[model samples]
Target: MYPTNIKMKKKDKRKVAKAVRGAIKAGIKENIKLFLNTKKFGRIILAKLHI
Candidate 1:
């Protein structure tokens, strides 16, 4: 959740939504690959999203 002071107008919200969609479409595979390669404490995090 964002703070109340950070108010987003409808137009700005639409632009952000469009950019996020485009980024996800273009970089989803690369993002997942990078995430999987990330390591902490000699262990890897395996995440599953249930839709």
Candidate 2:
């Protein structure tokens, strides 16, 4: 029983770590999307100016 409990605790720790990693990845993706959108918008504006 004690061994099983220990194993469960380890699994929980792994799950928490994976969740944290996924959150970080999601944040980075969001930032990249925002950056790309802004860049495209700027390009469009520049084109309108015939630059």
Candidate No. with top TM-score: 2
Clashing pairs in 1: none
All models: lDDT?
Answer: 0.70, 0.75
Which candidate's lDDT is highest?
A: 2
Q: Report, for all candidates in order, the number of backbone clashes.
A: 0, 0
Candidate 2 per-residue lDDT, tens place, 1-51, comes to 355534557789999999999999999977766675579785565557653
For each candidate in turn, the TM-score is 0.44, 0.59
Question: Model 1, range 1-51, lDDT digits (tens) per residue?
Answer: 766787799999999999999989879866765666686522244444312
What count of clashes does model 2 give? 0
Local distance difference test, candidate 1? 0.70
- Window of ten residues with lowest summed lDDT in model 1: 41-50
Name the lDDT value of residue 32 in candidate 1.
65
